[model samples]
Target: MTARCSMRLEERSARHIDFTGREDRPVQIHLRDIKRTPGPPNPAGLDHDMSPPPRLQQVPTSPLLSAFSAHRSETLSAGRALFVEGDSGSDIHLLESGLIALSHIQPNGKRMIASFVVGNGVFSLSHDGMRLLTAEALQECRLRRVHRVELSHLPADQAEAVKAALDREPWDIQAETLMHLHKDADEGISYFLVRLAGRLNGPISRGSRVRLDMSRVDIADHLGLTVETVCRGLKRLRSDRVIDAAGPHNVIILEPDQLKRRAGLGPDFD
Candidate 1:
């Protein structure tokens, strides 16, 4: 299943979905910025964090992208939907830059965040042909969309590049499943923070402060916990000197090794 995103207080119905957002001009970035980074063959971290100040990597550039000339990039303002549930699945997106949240709304009106997408990640509608989740920008973002029709005609190597990108989606679902097995909310929260920290390394090292781009509510939804529970978990971590919530959105991982243990991550994952 493809992960998607949503964050709104409005009463939502499948019949009516909105894409309203704050005023922000479309940003244009060159295709050279659309690099490909390999995701772990197995789900390596907790909920995949896509926060800024990224952990830059060296991965092969998708030569397939050079073949396309007609597609144009578009800017997605913060809180805007790149595509809503039930929208046409005409294209799959390549996140050029910035963070995006993937979420799903249950029939009872509760929302569950699927995962987060950082730069170079790919997201699309559900595979069955209609959009199944809502993908919303957590911050101002720019992305390139390749039409599904265009994808079908690509040569083998180019097609493989796209497939490799899409392979990361299943790993997220698996990670989410693994998180729930522990049954401890604090452990789950630790797992979540550790994953975010892994992606957004600090200037000096991985132990530095990590800026959380998503809100407490988003974290709660992704972990299947309540906002209050999420708050308490952070508070507990703070009390133990495991982490420091420096501000509403900034967190400093005081003990990286201990944090991994709390998340049930072994030395191999570390």
Candidate 2:
């Protein structure tokens, strides 16, 4: 005979967890949630196209430049170095007019141009740190140099806008650098032309043209190609009837679609 013991189970009422402590935690802010003042409406009466092509969208107008315009402005002649690599990055530069080239020096002392900073572009955003790349004026330029402390003193909204722009700058440089690195000389040249056309806001018509102010040497440096290779590539594009040269600095896109294909941008072209 075995004596069995009976066990009884009792259910307890569920208790609500306290989330009051979580309410005291800091709320994270997102870049997209920061609203920016709308820019002036287009005078051309064209409806604003929010979704631009990748190449065109790569360099958007920086709110930092606008906010800092009155701080300090200086003009530099063509071929002048704005800042050399390894220099103290106490200040950031905003290109108001003309072009600036950002380059890196190799161990052998050869300079490799990495990217071009066009008007309304910001560069050297290291902010009181050592500069990562050398900046030079590709053409006569007017730039506004703002000290890191000044940027820090900006209003919260404007400061956030500047931060967003600064965050995007490196990714733009990498995308352009990789674009040139992976393509053949001809394709690279075509890509450069297409990019310039887009930047210049040239018409998208078949017969539309764009003026490339940079010389062949500049193009070579920017595209990571030899000057001779750039010349040959240009000649090939001309022969293919994809483009025609109005002068040494001007290029007409005779066949926009064909040029886009050669640039590896695909059939959608724009």
Candidate 3:
């Protein structure tokens, strides 16, 4: 792409999106800035983003946000880093929709997948005294972010309210991923897909299709697996008669119950 951006972090307090080739005004943008390039139906790389980043649209408007005058929004492309660990924590996103892989990059450059946050998940939440981790888009993602100043003003109960919204998703299989420092590629990949199917749609639908919104490579990167292994897991599930590839991005579930059993959930969860 034609849009040139140097790597630097700047603060913003504006009402409009930072589009129109402006210098950094809390606006939204594509991952690589390929403006003229024509995108495809699924545009393998094209983001399924809103026009000017996602608006502050999630329900239960954050009382914390009341302290801030402006907000920043952006759409993240799959596989792109949202924020690397150790970077100064500034803002947090109110994810509209999509799979977000939170992983860690080692000094040796090896990566370890941590968690795949979906739906109304918040990316920055410190609990029991732990710092932030890395976050990246596992698929075309739309997000609205508010600055830390806003967080600082969160009323005790209101702040707790926002935190409660993020918690409650039961920390079982996926929560165990936080401690991983090294990559377990294979097992990690399996756990990720299981969580994805478990998170977005319910488990495999007895005799229906399941759509995989994120790509294999993003899945691999998020799960610490090679692309090949991610594909293998999908094939393995199909072989077991648990699921079927319905189309490029869809999978049919022959036995949703079986898939739930693997994801640490009961068949009667509904």
Candidate 4:
């Protein structure tokens, strides 16, 4: 990715000024070749569209699942996009299992992950029948798509559940947005981990283990921080004994109260 910088000079050179206010001199730009970090090997034959039309495997069904699966059920292999931004959004999606990411492509072609939909989460309730973000599978996923009209036909209990899920989405997004408001990187990262742990690992206790489904890159994009900042923040958290990194994809909450303190949150924040 090309990095950009802004410059200001009072010399009125009427020419491009470099970072140090040097004018009328060729600004030397250095290109660095950085190797992409290797992640898990891609699943074979799963790229460039899930051929033969992905279908869901049989699983025990529930009232909510049955209602949502009325029209269609599908699966997406890891790394496959379920839908891109600007796609028609007449149907709502219920993620039965695995992880999905909702993101937007900026004008500069950078992707900003808006949120992640964990298992049993409901998403894509678009107000204008238009998708504002793209949805992609972070893991092999099972999902159901139901037409908007079908929501009214669901049983009262199921309808209420759906309503509650939708209701929580805004608050969740708001909390994430608030995380970005903090100027301190560690504070923002701590708050993000706490919110994510609540969603992925249930109630936050000292021993709660959160499976980090999203990568550091994803976290950086979602939190509006550089990857280096995220790395440093996590290092500080570990050093302070607030959390422990079990692996590349697992984190254990060591001192929940301390973590909340670091995040500038109350004990009852979660």
Candidate 5:
């Protein structure tokens, strides 16, 4: 017997139903033909309700970023490759502005987006001396490239700052792995938005929006879901009033607690 599932977008939510079939072959359902209802209009004066969260206010800049502020920077145009997978890891790339995507290509040639490193972030951290994934600019990016050996030559205080930043890398990697393993598509998307909002240097409050530089396809790749699934998930969120979209790339979180609930995160999570 073959097992099959059918998913339909309800007026207020999305649900899937499973069924058993007598056929000996697996069943595949195509979702390409499904249509999403247009989202509601943005309410007038919605921006006034949004405020920057308290944590975003008065946060100090990273000492590591300050230590390297005087260094010469490099720029890459959108869609340019920063480094290739399996390349020798020679430099740590610090993002000054714009978005960078870290991705891995499987042996089957499928490219999976692992994460996005926004400004004030560092990438290419590995214990082994080789790149495990490729890095590319999602937009025109400004970056500071520091060779590994150069860190040891820095002033003691500056070097310590860099070390402290590097120490947190493992925690981030572990958290990302856990998020992927634990959440379904809907929860994952909500968690991604919350994390992205927290990373932004500016203020984010209820009704405050985050601009997503990546496309829906890119988001799906990062979350390990199909494009259709991401779209359906977003639609459900919007319909439930947990979030709203100003446009395709910008998401305004309407209800932070509700969004966090959808993400399966605790209330204390920023």
Candidate 6:
């Protein structure tokens, strides 16, 4: 590039010297108009001669996940793939609102969703995307994707948590924490619901039946259970008067203590 710069300067200098030698009468050469050769290419080192016209780059955005910068942020409609398996990881994503389904597509094109992350969900965040899964927004949503290279350094606690979450599938999260006297999708779903109820309200009481914040399909995906199984499990609970469905997104706890017992008793819990 420096060689190219020097040649350009030489060409311009030769032209300036021959100014009066033209066929026209003597013309005042505005000496000020002779621009000095630009100092060693500006820090960007871009070749001015061959560079393409610059487009309006999307805003210099920041990642909601943390301090990282994002190059793109937009509202994605349902069924949009944020990332695909085996693809190189260039960015980490954060779903500020709405839900996203994470799935693994089998060789036969069957999709087995591992989880459905809702508002404040994070994705594609491993150092190299070791746990590869395809993320698709299940509903209209807003997302932010930041270049991984730009976020090499992060604070201690957040960095550790995000890294661990990236290394393992979402199922591993509940599996590691919940003791399974009879570990299975059924029991996992029970535990998940009971916990969610407690989180949203309090310990199971007369009105303690948990109302799922997500849909039945979302719950099934998170627990590795089939949709039918999830529905049956909920129905079983309902028959036992543990809960009553107020509507699609609403449920009333009928027997909180019994529901907790059905989840299996623990001395620590008692």
The TM-scores, one per candidate, come to 0.69, 0.71, 0.60, 0.72, 0.74, 0.57
Model 5 alpha-carbon drift over 4 Å, by segment: 1-61, 201-204
Error of 4 at 134 (Å): 1.0
RMSD, one per candidate, in order: 12.8, 26.4, 12.2, 12.1, 15.4, 23.8
Supply the global lDDT for candidate 2. Answer: 0.64
Off by over 4 Å in 2: 1-62, 125-128, 202-204
TM-score of 6: 0.57
Q: Candidate 1, TM-score vs. the true structure?
A: 0.69
What shift in Å separates residue 44 of candidate 5 from its native position after superposition?
Answer: 46
Task: Single out the weakest 10-residue window by summed lDDT for candidate 3.
Answer: 14-23
Better of 1 and 2 by TM-score: 2
What is candidate 1's CA lDDT for residue 190? Answer: 83
lDDT of 4 by residue, 156-218 (tens): 876776667667776776677766776478778888889888887676999899888766666
Each model's lDDT comes to 0.63, 0.64, 0.53, 0.67, 0.67, 0.52
Ranking 2 against 3 by TM-score, winner: 2
TM-score of 3: 0.60
Model 1 regions more than 4 Å off:
1-71, 152-156, 202-206
- Show pairs that collide, candidate 5: none
Rank ordering of all candidates by lDDT, starting from the highest: 5, 4, 2, 1, 3, 6
Off by over 4 Å in 3: 1-72, 77-79, 125-131, 152-158, 165-174, 178-191, 202-204, 207-209, 262-270
Better of 1 and 2 by lDDT: 2
Q: What is the lDDT of candidate 5?
A: 0.67
Model 1 lDDT tens row, 1-270? 543333222222211111121223433211101112334322111122244433673333566454232345566666555666665574677777788877676777666677888776777756667776777676778776777777767777777777666676767766776766665897888888877776666222344787876766667778889767777788778788877766566888788777778888764463
- Supply the TM-score for candidate 5: 0.74
C-alpha lDDT of residue 187 in model 4: 79
Best by TM-score: 5
Error of 3 at 38 (Å): 26
